[model samples]
Target: MTPYPRWTLRTEHTGYTVRLSPDGPWAELDAWGPHGAEHGPSALDWSHRTHFITPADAAPAEYLPYGIRPFTGAELIAAGPDGERGSWWEFDGAQETGTGLRLAFTDGLLGLRTVLCYETVPGTDIVLRWTEFTASRELRLERLDSAAVTVPVTAGARLTYLTGQWSQEFQRTQLHLTRGTFTMGSIQGVPGHAYAPWLAVQDTTGEDAPAYGVALEWSGNWHITAEAEPGGAVRVRAGRVPHEGAVRLAPGERLTTPRLACAFSADGLDGLSRVWHRYERRLSGERLHRPRKVLYNSWEATGFGVEAAGQLELARAAAGIGAELFVVDDGWFTGRADDTGGLGDWHPDPAAFPDGFDRFVADVRALGLDFGLWVEPEAVSPGSRLHTEHPDWVYRVDGRPARLVRHQLLLDLGRTDVQDFVIATLDRLLDTYAIDYLKWDMNRPPTERGRPSAGPADLDAEHVAGYLRVLDHLRAAHPGVTVEGCAGGGGRVEHATIARTDVVWPSDNTAPLDRLAIQHGFLHAHAPHVMSSWVTDAPGVFDPRPRSLAFRFVNAMCGVLGIGADLRAWTPAQRAEAAGWIARYKEVRDVVHLGEARLLGTPADPTCGVQYDADGRTVVAALSTGRLDGAPLVPGRPARLRLRALDPAARYRDTASGTTYSGAHLLHYGLPFAWSADHDADLVVLTRE
Candidate 1:
């Protein structure tokens, strides 16, 4: 297969040049001055044009939807060494429409300045940002700070169009409106509403395709700006604003809007955020909640069968290992002997231990480890007493029953009674249990659509409001306990969710190699407190050596550290190694977790993948995942590496290998080392001495 040409800027109008960089998937359209302007009788006529077909066999097939829309007319704008400036086209889409665009360039890359001038009727604009960039596609749209402004809106308008690949085949199109703060109300035939601004069009074929739409009709106005940076981050900001409707775009006339997209190879979330921060400073606030020290969870070792004795043993083990917290997961709840039972019953099961619940809590505290409990609060098994009593509490269609997962059904969070029950239950647990943390688990999605007897709006309000209310109640009732949100793992790990909770469970698939990719994807815009586990998984699971342990530990250091395996079963040597690494991690935890991180290299290269903290301390973990095979014990010289974010004047030492090197030598000459034939590796932690 031929490689796609990298986009660049050209002086000739007829010649097309596209530039693909971390900053943008930018394109330049330069034509000589004194060009003819295309005019039409009606605005609608000018707006009509053929839509581009997104290639079907796009690799990383996930990144599809690529296209361009030209304006109805072009005018002889101007010509100079800087570049040509003209109003080529205008568009008044769902949100604010653009009136004209000014184009200029330095070197060859075209910088397009879009002017937005349209009125929103009745409602207001709340959040607006130009978003263009995918994990795979080479597209770039940067936001220019000098030319951006946040304006008020006072109107309601709609922009509808067919987007996505299926739009042409199924005639399905995504719809958007700008009546207020942009929110997705509902899709064509979907019965539910969306709080976010975007919606996916699902129809494969039919007239209903165009019915899939989004709306900007929230209660308030939002400030919006889209900026492209030199790096790959496309900065989109939507600030709160008051309502106003001074400018309106009539039908057939196009208003210009600023939006861009870019593509890049696999740089994790840290790389993504760096690119964004380089251009926009609004996201630089200190994280709202700080994370705790390392923790150990009793899931793999004891499972759900753990009772008071097992719990106490685990707590002791945790304390011995210097783990800050001990979490007892799954089996402690009332009537829950295993995964399939007592899901909805929040009370502690009496049969699991003869002692009362308070005694168990006291025992855990006696071990000098903070206590945490797992609760799948949003679900209940059919046999659960709560399910038996309030059959109406679970979401269901007119007559169909929601299928069971792990023999459980998701509670209808939209119901006020359900919300009240959850709040009351959690409030009681915190007051009674002396708990320091709670793992909030949601294990299922919306499987059915049904309106409350009260109304649909109430249902919509409850979905989001219920979760927020739970957060509020948790904070109010148990000020000391941190709530970690988990959706059968990473499903609920988004910006909106992060605002309400502490850490996010990055993923359940915690194989060391896999986690490098997983945590990389998650950290782009998320805080490092996103939780990752050190557990044994296959491919390397059955290995008799510490290779698996080493792999898991390396991955866990990238995020919050929690052991998912049973420490009681670990050999003495393994335990010693684990404790040593945990202590080492604690030394640099604050610097990496709270500091500004820079990715010095990519994981694709063997000698790559170095990360630096805000204070200039660096942690470089290089592994030959493929090169480690049966071979002679020949050591290779380590490659000299350039440090990206370092204090040029600071002296440093390697914490692990006890090697001392100056910042200058480290930055200029890199490090020297050779890989052992046995796949020997190092977690070289550098700190100022």
Candidate 2:
């Protein structure tokens, strides 16, 4: 067997020195202070300590300092100038088996620990898994494991932590450690914040390391994936609660998390692709249908007093506009005319839709579009039938309604009956109507209920389980239907949520100007297909910028395009322009929807630029967001344009001006263009003869 190298650590003034051993499975970590001197050996003690530390303590010491602190049951074990803290802590590596290493570190001041594991299954090429961080004083456990190969790096790597803005030169250098091939990238520290920023580093061949994208949760849990281009990437997700920090640890506190990291060369990129392929295959095998681009809604169009005829008219309009699916946003179901009534009652309002939902679906389908309905599933109006029937489902405190937001109460999804009732209601609706889409909305956050179930653990688990069950049941019964997740719009945009739903309402506020920034932020980690909506707020909703409707269309084209305005009131010209843009979008929908996206200029940069290219064609968009002195001197000034993800050998012709440019010139010099004020323009490059 080829001997796997292990790392040796030496504490120094600069940072910790880590060396790899030619043979063995053990690694050493040494820490030093300002001046070069052996600060101490990284130690862990399961006997005296109350928690489990990875790379377990060598010599059972009465005093364990600066490494992963120990957790005894729900309490943390502390031993410092102070004595005997919590109890029942145990570190067991043998509990789970896989390929990877785990590290636990604590500096009397802060605690940091992580477990790295990799797993390979037969059908799936690689599966990287991990746990998300949650708000808890106790160490809640979750596991992230993946099936992938570990890439070996021959060159050394450096891990640096910077404070303040990322563009800034220096704030405070926390750790500058040298190790074999791998180093931590960005580690940030804020004085009072519980979670500090950190990055794991690995060496690439060139100056620009292949971008390792990161997805971070508000609760401090994060996942990192290596960008493997045309082929997908390898993802490293967190598993356990090894990185949680205690507010005040008098000279001693420990935290730990299960973490996994991998490094593979371009050769492994193919393997990674196969992994994603297998994942998709399994998903398909499970009959999980991919969600279609859906047209959705807001009550702004049909209004709160929409009757059967009004809804049917709107549905027909949507069908005429090439909308594949139509959703009855709100006011379709309920005895009340406005948002004030009928939330929990999953029945159609007889007054508003006198003909019944079955007929509405039939009318929508007859126009050649799929039918969809909206529901807040998680909330109940006080006057609703469901609330009157099962008042216990509403989360309350001290026999009073717990109000987090407006006149709504959270349904206790933690209860089996609640979950069953929701499932049955949705199932019956799908059976009754030819519904192809569901807009699942959660308007308020979880609050008031100290405990929804009998136990705290059960309540917490049920909260997560409830969502999963709802999604699972929906996918199982309505395999052909798509689900759109909207938590007051965009608030619930997370990886876990994305895995379950097809599209996310980027924001309820889809004003064009607001969309530019919001969409930019959303695309940081999410795919464009997930963000949906188009040209909203006619006569301008927020800012009275009577900008070209084409501008709004083009902006919304970046994602799934859907009109939020009342089409019935649109002028002939407005409708014509929308139809043209929609037609153009349909022509190149696949490329833009699934293509690689690159932000050419920084959000703060004067020249805001973005490019999207896939297959053989490319679209370059530039906006002169900042003030430009005057018209260009030579029709167009030399713009420092940087192109991304393009076929260097392909010849191209610009669709706008019928101009021709070589791929080389386009990449090197960029397409020269000028704009005035907030003027934005786009150039489409098509394959040439």
Candidate 3:
């Protein structure tokens, strides 16, 4: 309707609008928010543009090169052979696709063409955006960001993100920005534990305020920077494959950045989280409907002391407790006595499996469970034969010393020969063994990341591409096998990894309370179906508050439940109790995995839990973390938890206690619970009547 050329990308309940700048050749964001936001006043219209700054710097330009946005940050920065930087690009053309639009620009002098892409994810409120560059002549790229998003703000931006260390990952963090730039990312080759590739921004800090978020679909080194300008706008730019210096793009070659997912919710962080979950469901495709197995992993039970007899013993105990899968963890392969040896060697250890590997797998299947194995294909120990045979396959800075984090060096998966070797090893393993599940792990990040053979190449980008290729191969070549993605516990968790892998290990520290807190933050950014939680006997180093077995089972049941405890050591009564819990988990897993998820009070609260609703059924996992002797409950005053997103007009009946209550009463008065020292957790299931 306006004179400017405008484009609107619509989702189920949101809209994003962009318009060609009236004063320039580039495009700028006009509006972005819930449905009908475009019909109202433009939130991003800057009334006062600071003097001395270029128009591109003050405008909400979509994507611009250095010359256009010289003062402010740029999405693309390139140089010619003579070291001349920046580009004077003019609008070339624009094309509309079924999902979204593609806008192209060209710098004839530099012989460069760039296209900014946008695709609204089907059935979701998230918009996937990326950028592509093709050169008629060679260019050195100093920075090639995927996309830059502008958020409307009055005072400043309230940013919420996730960050943590090795055993403690996915810690929800927050920052308030009135001015200056705030940045977070990983430069360690992998999306490290220091920061998750996600960020949520809002104008104000409140539980019910409108919020916007962005997540990068990159597993390699990446950076996300948010700048608050004096013109009352906040621009966020995110990119991948970050390196120490520039990457070269030869003539006729195309360089495409990873997709950056943008989402908006008027109902605050909770709504923003649901938007993310729905997009993840789109990524999962048909796999979202499939049931995640209740498996038993032998990592906590046996560690590196893997053997046929011991594994069979654990398998028997696991199967007796109704486990659907049995995975022999590390040390199943030859030379793997400890962390120092047996990586890159995929063959079964003759010493561990006295009987052939086939016999070992068959024996586990005979116990009525599917076989699984743990593998770290991208890692090689100094004592490994693969490292000795192909020293050049590992990443190193030629003459610099390579540092080992877990007594292992990372393979340069960017190389075709190395990728082929990895593919062949995995193919051979799957073909030879009756493996139904594969737990792919990466123990450490790359040190001195360099490829001497391919000089001046973007090693980080190459590795990410190669890693995705192998995953695609597994998905196509071995369709029936389930893949669980891990990186010493949640280092590689992002859209790219989540889209390919079936489930992901949230953390290695499965001590009940700590895991509950970790999973709390994890579910805020990811869906429960991909969250593979385990019940382990490992003592909590963070919170040593001893919890009962029931607490452990209930905590793990919040996601794709798995048991890593030493079942052989559990007594007859304990095992019987576990069997009961596992059976209960199976009954409600469908709703927990595929239904709408709502996180209750946080783990910091006295009582907190997670609730799921689907198909007229609702499940709630309530846990009490307060001191047992701290507060005495007055008689007849039970703890009540108010549920969310329920049909208030309907009547609900509890399946466990056979009690019926009006939905109005349930919503207002909440579900009641009686907590004791021995009974600190409860799993409640209800059906609408």
Give one digit per residue, the lDDT tens place, for model 1 in 1-689: 21422222111111111211112222211111111211212111111122442112111110111122122111112122233332222221222123222232221222222332222111111112232211121112211111121111122122222111110111112333232232222221111111222222212232222111112211112222222212111122332221111112222332222222111111323343443222112221234325565777787777778788887887887788778888888888887876677877899888776788888888888888788988887888888899999988986666666777667777877677899999988888888888898998776555554554643232333455577678778866676677787765554543345545667675565555555545544444344544445544423222223345665676677667787777778888878877887887787676556655555444444544436465657776544443442334554455545665566677788876788888788778876645554344456788777
Q: Candidate 2 lDDT, tens digit per residue, 1-689?
A: 22432222211112222222122122222221122423343221112222233322322211122222132111123332333342222222322334323332222222222222223233432223222122223332222222111122234332222222211211223222233122122111101011112222334443243222122322122222221111111112222122222222211233223222221112222222222323323333433334345374546687666677877777666666666667778777766577667887878878776777687678878888777788888788888888898888866656655674666777877678889988898998888878888889776665665443454333433554676689888877787877887766654544445567767675666665555655554443345666676676645343444445655777777767777677777777766766676777776666655555665654345455556666767766554444455665545454456665555676688776788877777777777765554445443555543
- lDDT score, candidate 3: 0.90
What TM-score against the true fold does each predicted structure earn?
0.62, 0.68, 0.98
Error of 1 at 465 (Å): 2.1
Name the regions of candidate 2 deviating beyond 4 angstroms: 1-291, 294-298, 399-401, 538-546, 606-609, 621-624, 627-629, 632-641, 647-649, 655-657, 674-679, 683-685
Report clash pairs, candidate 3.
none
Q: Which sequence of candidate numbers ranks them by TM-score, best first?
A: 3, 2, 1
RMSD of each: 15.7, 10.9, 1.4
**Residue ranges of candidate 1 with Cα displaced over 4 Å:** 1-271, 275-291, 452-461, 535-546, 607-610, 621-624, 629-635, 639-642, 647-651, 656-658, 662-664, 677-681
* lDDT, each prediction: 0.48, 0.49, 0.90
lDDT of 3 by residue, 615-661 (tens): 99999999988765444644445677889888889999999999988
Alpha carbon lDDT of residue 47, candidate 1? 19
- Which residues of candidate 3, in runs, are more than 4 Å off? 628-636
